[model samples]
Target: MPYHIDLFAVFILLGVVQAIFLSFFFLSRENRKNDVNFFQGLMLLSMAACILEIFLMYTGYIVDCLFLVDFSEPFALAIGPSFYLMIRSLIHGSVSRKMQLVHYIFPVVYFFLLIPFLIQSNDFKYNSWVYAYHPNLPFRDVSVGYDPRWLWVTDHHTLMSLVSIGIYFLFGLVEVIRAFKEKRESFFAPVHSVLKKLRSGILHMTSATVIIFVVKYLNIDDTGDHLFAAYISFTIYLTSFNVISHSGFFRQVALSEPQKYKSSGVTADAQKELLDKLAMLMTRDKPFLQSGFSLPELAGKLNTTVHVLSQVINDGLGKSFFEMVAEYRVEEAKRLLKEQPHVKVEEIAEQVGYNSKSSFNTAFKKISGKTPSEFRSA
Candidate 1:
């Protein structure tokens, strides 16, 4: 077989570039705010590394430099965990260190499994790459360079990759569904849109992984490589599409911003007082009516730390910052719609801090069981 860069190879290379740029863009300070962005960056970076391995293999670089091949296997193993963490953080705010360690067990195990292959002599690796897998290739005599044991290693990697991604994909789907339900009940317009985009991306990525895993599991020997190439290319393309479309992933605030309150030692009574003050501030000042309002700004106005305010909003009030803001904005929109019947929907949306009328409508409908128009007409 002649080794050449095909269209799939081009796509794989493009995917690598796109993923790396997105990863770096998300990891940079401008994009880094919350665990969601951090994990999204990790996912994109992992994807770039994995796809780069594929690109190298198809381009025959892996044959020239066998050491580079081992990294791909572990990187491929990392996709499931990275993807899971990204979605989990998007839905759940932040993940615990223990959970992160638990999710990485598969990648760690795969890294150890590749130890034997990694320690092999360069000549041994090059020979194995040329003759161990590819059949009927020129300048490589299969009988002289082939290692029978390598087939088992490759097969194990494939099997484990399938199982890991399948499990995590299902787990991710559950989380997405749970988040959808919560968002519906909570009326968080800003984050609801974010959740919808996140769910769509997760579903697409998960479907691609599932299709590839199922095809590989079926073990169609003749077309397996071709199928793998096509599916992997599709997966990369889908991921690139998602990253481009769901730009909200890059806008999240960091999880560690609330770290200052970890040892603040505020008692229950003090938290209650803060909550009352927060209520008074929201009721009297109507700060949520301000466009681009933030938890830090709210905390500052209340003469409190962001950590304590965040804790009060999340734990004491059982609402996220966005949810609380949406609640107030929706109520304000209701009053305006009721009193100012002649006002335009867009103007009303602008007045209530929703930059988008659709967002305002979504929040209104979610909270009042009617769109702004319907509410006004009633």
Candidate 2:
């Protein structure tokens, strides 16, 4: 109640608002019900709650209302695991339920450890807030003489969080590096682009964590300028949201469905029949020539599930749906380039199922190793 709203408080308050908005925004997406969305939303919610508590403390509201002091730990403990889980989901595509439970163990244990403080009497809480945690008290003195229980909960929580996040960041870095090293050249360029963004995201998060750790280690966190941490956190969330929004996660396409493939046994004979039918469909019917053609539509025409078709494309044909489509479109574009040398590249692109000239150029270059105009000339 005694604190005034300064510039630092205003910025951190804005970060808190943004984090909260992003959390619900991701959570509300019906199509994105997977580890990626769930973990990212959980991470945002955790960060929002922690930042809100910091904002409250910075505004001196925590001092006025003693109960808030006991609420921050649960959210704080959740940050490390949520962050790790989010990255894991992005890299691995999905996380097992057992692994999810394993990540949550620390936060759950820490939550129960705070039970004693949560049940404290109002008078005791008030006295503790006034005498032990008064804003006027020096930061150094606040933890030095406190009840070990309080010290253990607060100090250990901060230390454990740094360690946990740091360890996960290192693990995520290894996963990103491995992903790059193991990447196949034949993957769809669009999917490859998304993977590159994911790699950058992993590095960005690791760098942010390092900065936060450095600030904490240098005791910059003690200067009451919690704005530094809030700004860094906001940057991370903003970058993550942009990447996720554009990465096709929000689409109806199944990115993280656990049961992507069903157990319908397609025998060797069935597979060859399906392959022949697929060849006829592509060569004769030319479904890929249609604008906005999708896997579901093609699967329906073939009288098969999307999963079965996807497996046939990925395992049987050794190509993704995007790759297959792009290959056909680019080959058609090349034929047009040879036949109608006077036609514009954009016109050819539209004729060959590409909506944008840029996309056509990218796909053409990726497939043929030359731009559309270059292909035309050569």
Candidate 3:
């Protein structure tokens, strides 16, 4: 092993480690289980690729093992798709069966194209550009060969990923805005933390993609001197991983849930104002989102107490506070379902602050005389 780590290689190695750490750290949430299996698999695959690259960079930098240098390029190609899949999962809440097939699309396309140059050139093992290398003063002195021809296929890999990140970023932004807008129907009305995190991460990854290419194309390759540009790109990757996977990032998960406020018998205009305020409280302060939401707790939120809120619902809304709250929640859910038919029922229930599907279903049926699905379909 050599004592000198190529400043450039060291920089890239650090990026890989940081990405792996964040990936494992964020992807561990038990709640993200939708066909999350694909994303989970992609993360693991990307993790392995990072680990191998880190190992190769470390060995070549320290131990002078040249084989590692060349082996990691193929793995780099694999990273592109893993990122694409992660974006897909975050935005769609699951991967498409079609896109899963789409994952293999590029690697397969490149294998044949790259094979030609590999055999034509013996670089399999020297300067590592077209081949393997010893060290130079500037960097690891390795060149993975940017043959313009390589870009023909590799470019597709880059382009598709940029597109994936772009699409999810938009999807996530719309959902978040819908979640917060005081409107009757948010794009992701009753938007949840998963939607928020997914969106934020999508934005981060898109930036990362932009930075990496900007540096590569701008020739910021630096002979490995100031690798800050590349390091920042990888750190973004780390941030994105956490954004995608960490459940605690969901602020709602900690807030109390909306309770079925029991109606009080006090019918009047005064009560309608209170109901409007309740809607405002849920949207603004967000205490009603907690799974622990209780009539008493919420009344406390507006300084009125459970009794007054109950009176308002029963008298003004012609229902008990419990019924009114549930009604509000169900209606909120109903609106989202009507617009985003693509969202799952369970997710919609969660968004409106319901703890389970059965409760949402039972209440929805009681109010609308149909299941949420049936109402949506109608």
TM-score of 2: 0.58
The regions of model 3 sitting more than 4 angstroms off are 1-3, 6-33, 40-63, 73-75, 78-80, 111-123, 129-192, 220-378
After superposition on all C-alphas, the RMSD of every candidate to the true structure, in Å, is 15.1, 15.7, 13.9
Tens-digit lDDT string for candidate 2 (1-378)? 368688778778878778877778678754245567788788778877877777776676775676776476777677777777777766555688899899888788877777766766555555545443364653322222335356465546667777777887777677666666656532224235436556666756767777767767776334433745566556745655674655433344343544533343444444555565677578767788887999998886665668777877776788999899999988888999999999999899899888899999999999999999998888
Question: Which 10-residue window of candidate 1 scores lowest in summed lDDT?
Answer: 140-149
lDDT of 1 by residue, 1-378 (tens): 356777877777777777787778778874455566677787777767766766776677676566775477777777788878878866544687899889988688767767766776766666655553464554433242544335465556767777777888888878877877855744234244446556666756766776676666675332244445456556656656765554434444466756644445555555765676677678878989888899988876665568778887887888899998999999998899888889999999999898998888888898889999988888
**Which 10-residue span in candidate 3 carries the lowest summed lDDT?**
220-229
TM-score of 1: 0.58
Assess candidate 1 and give its lDDT: 0.71
Ranking of predictions according to lDDT: 1, 2, 3
Stretches of candidate 2 above 4 Å error? 29-32, 122-155, 184-191, 220-225, 240-378
The Cα error of candidate 1 at residue 56, in Å, is 2.1
Pairs with backbone N, CA or C atoms under 3 Å apart (clashes), candidate 2: none
Error of 3 at 135 (Å): 9.5
Which parts of model 1 have CA positions greater than 4 angstroms off? Answer: 137-155, 184-191, 218-378
lDDT computed for candidate 2: 0.70
lDDT of 3 by residue, 1-378 (tens): 354456555566666666555556545453233344345445544545544444454345423444443333344455556555665554333565787677656555665665544443333333443112234423333355556345555435435434544554455455445544634343333334334444554555557556655644554222221233345435545555554543333333223543422222233333654566566666666564456678887765554546666766565667776676787787778789988999999999898888899998999999889999899889
RMSD of 1: 15.1
